[model samples]
Target: MNFDDLRTGSAVHQFPGVLLGHNVRIFHPHLVNLYGCAIGDDSRIGTFVEVQKGAVIGARCKVSSHSFICEGVHIDDEVFIGHGVMFTNDARPRATNDDGSPQSEADWKVELTRVKRRASIGSNATVVCGVTIGEGALVGAGAVVTRDVPDFSIVAGVPARVIGDTRQPVSKAELTA
Candidate 1:
């Protein structure tokens, strides 16, 4: 939606240049820094979150508190971003140029990271740039995702490795024993 269609006055004092869909809820508006991003319908953004420009959060998604969703990151529908999760856009970040001058936006390229539908990223996860988190995938807490995760897979640990498939259900006998 356009700027004019955005919620006015007290309802959106902290949010500027944000394209918010109908029923989008941002808890503690004063505590979050959301700018130039599009949040789809029925999405909930928690406190202390910063959703940067060019970031798109899909419908029915829940972004927990203290998370950082940087530019060029696209999260699909039904996604769950847990508390303190961080997303990076630049692979090689530099403070200054070859001439020792301060680096600008044009100095570095922003790599895109896509979280496919139904993915759940647990608390304190760090998702590196240019990787697609497959649909229905589960990224365990404190995971440092450096590669693409397969669909319905459970990934954990630094440099996140696939531990199991969600589709494979544990037998009742195993549960009883």
Candidate 2:
């Protein structure tokens, strides 16, 4: 392998002490800024993934390409964030304030969004602020999550209504298999 011929992107650390756990891989790191974020062990962040300030990603999580994880977002262990998934911190986003000035951080509240352990958010899903995606819940592709999802449930559509329950009664053989 020729060193000069190899193509690689830089991982720009804007903030000091950004804790990255063991065996973590960030691809095309130069395309985004990872500031004040903590990524856990065995995690993989794909190209164009922007993990903003104060965002916490747990162990063994996979955040795909072009995903925006803003502040006040907490993703638990084993979570899957698909490509193009966007998370909003402000419920009501405004460009300017009442006095015709640009809205700063103090102008609005930053709502918290939590994705519980083992939850999977599909591609192009938009997660609104102040919502908790329950454990093992699956948000379908292009779904807009607006509220708290129940545990082990499958949610889809514009408002992300519960489509089905993942917890089904199973036999001993099924569990063993």
Candidate 3:
């Protein structure tokens, strides 16, 4: 049976020759086409997700539905990207340059956004360009992240602010004390 024959609720739009690793699961294969992107092993991509050219998603990541992973985005291993998440790569966004002409590839620069290992981005979060989300950080839902987030920090709200820190793993002796 073909992909169209599968009786799923939605269809995935996977572009030909997407570099998907072993054991990857794409629910709506017809709704996403990751031609130039590279998804690592054991990753799961939900419906309506679009991973643009040159984007790299590391191993064991979960990218939820309606998320847009644009070019210049690099997500490390074990990351959790929630639903409706948006990643931007252009800081100075404009239709035209100083010459008043339409912008071309050479006229703009693509800033890199890096999500470090084990970070969790909540639903509807908008991550701006040129920011580093540190390892194990938790970004709360609906947060607009505009700066670097420290490791194990929890951030929320517009232009996201650090609200708390993630609990570090404690040994049995420390827990008893």
Candidate achieving the largest TM-score: 1
Report the lDDT tens digits of candidate 2 across residue range 1-177: 112322222232443546677677887666756877788877899988888888988888999999999999999999999999999999889999989999988997899999999999999999999999999998989999999998998888898887776676434443222
The model with the greater lDDT, 1 or 2, is 1
Ranking by TM-score: 1, 3, 2
Tens digits of per-residue lDDT for model 1 on 12-70?
A: 55676787877888898888999888887788999999999999988889999999999
* TM-score-best of 1 and 3: 1
Those runs of model 1 whose alpha carbons end farther than 4 Å from true positions after fitting are: 1-10, 170-177
- Candidate 3 C-alpha lDDT tens digits along 35-122: 5777777789998899998898888999999999999999998999999999999999999988899999887789999999999999
Worst 10 residues of 1 by lDDT: 1-10
For each candidate, the alpha-carbon lDDT, in order, equals 0.88, 0.84, 0.84
Model 3 residue 3 lDDT score: 23
Cα displacement (Å) at residue 103, model 1: 0.6
Candidate 1 global Cα RMSD:
3.9
Q: Residue 58, candidate 2: how far off, in angstroms?
A: 0.3
Lowest summed lDDT across 10 adjacent residues in model 2 is found at 1-10
Ranking by lDDT: 1, 3, 2
State the lDDT at 84 in candidate 2: 98
